[model samples]
Target: MLKKLFGLTASFAALVGLPAGAWAQTAKDADPAIWVVKDADTTIYLFGTVHVLKPGLSWFDEGVKAAFDKSDEVVLEMIEPDAATMQGVIIKAGLSMTGPGLSEKLPKESLPALAVAAKDLGMPESALERFEPWLAAMMSAMAPLSKYC
Candidate 1:
């Protein structure tokens, strides 16, 4: 089960267009483009909502709402993750991988940024060592989470 779970995690990482190692480190804020919309014709447009974040983040952006109001049926990005599904993904993936820890991943050289970001996120070094990579990995999968925050 653990092996399969790990493989599933890897598969999900790839499916989301991120590397497995992306789970192990803190990333800077980046524009969310996991979801996109483009015009198919003068009378039609397509909205692709990747089910990777909280809808509260960018789901109702002026442009997206305007596009929705302009259109008829809504085509979502693979059915969006409801609270339950999102919770399953979060639970299965976030706390699974930890033995390697953040200390090894962050290195003594990068301690300063780690310290600051850790404080901001309320993570202590030892506790974070157990959690950092897993949470980071999960975030990399859910690009929308960062967008929401």
Candidate 2:
């Protein structure tokens, strides 16, 4: 029947969508570690690095240093994401501390989990109460991601 064909098509679309969504969550070429792999004549070194280096100490791997010193140009994720850009994204991403902010945007169910995690770390919830829920969620997510970023 026509109904059966429509159901099959919808199911197929749902199956195809998951990978695309996962890919969207990850950085395509942004990982710093991938540059370490081999290939071209112009060697691109992505130095694996510690998340937090001790004061006055650094791990500049030879290959990475060579690439940096040899290269005529350097680029970062952005020239700078200055105040205006930050404010704009805060507005757009709903990171504002006031109004509905990130609080209303998030599923109500996740709040208890967030509170528990913050408390477990001894990170006071009261201090963070004014922060937008989106920002809080990001801080929670990004804590583990510091190494990757």
Clash totals for all models, in order?
1, 1
Give candidates' CA RMSD values in order.
11.5, 17.6
lDDT of each: 0.48, 0.45
lDDT for model 2 comes to 0.45
Report the C-alpha displacement of residue 16, candidate 2, in angstroms.
37
Q: Report the lDDT tens digits of candidate 1 across residue range 1-149.
A: 44534444444443454222233134433233334445666455554434344332334445655766887676544443554454466556566364666767766887776666555443354544544565654533443344432
**Candidate 1 TM-score to native:** 0.42
Supply candidate 1's per-residue lDDT for 96: 32
Residue 138, model 1: lDDT of 52
Q: What is the lDDT of residue 86 in candidate 2?
A: 47
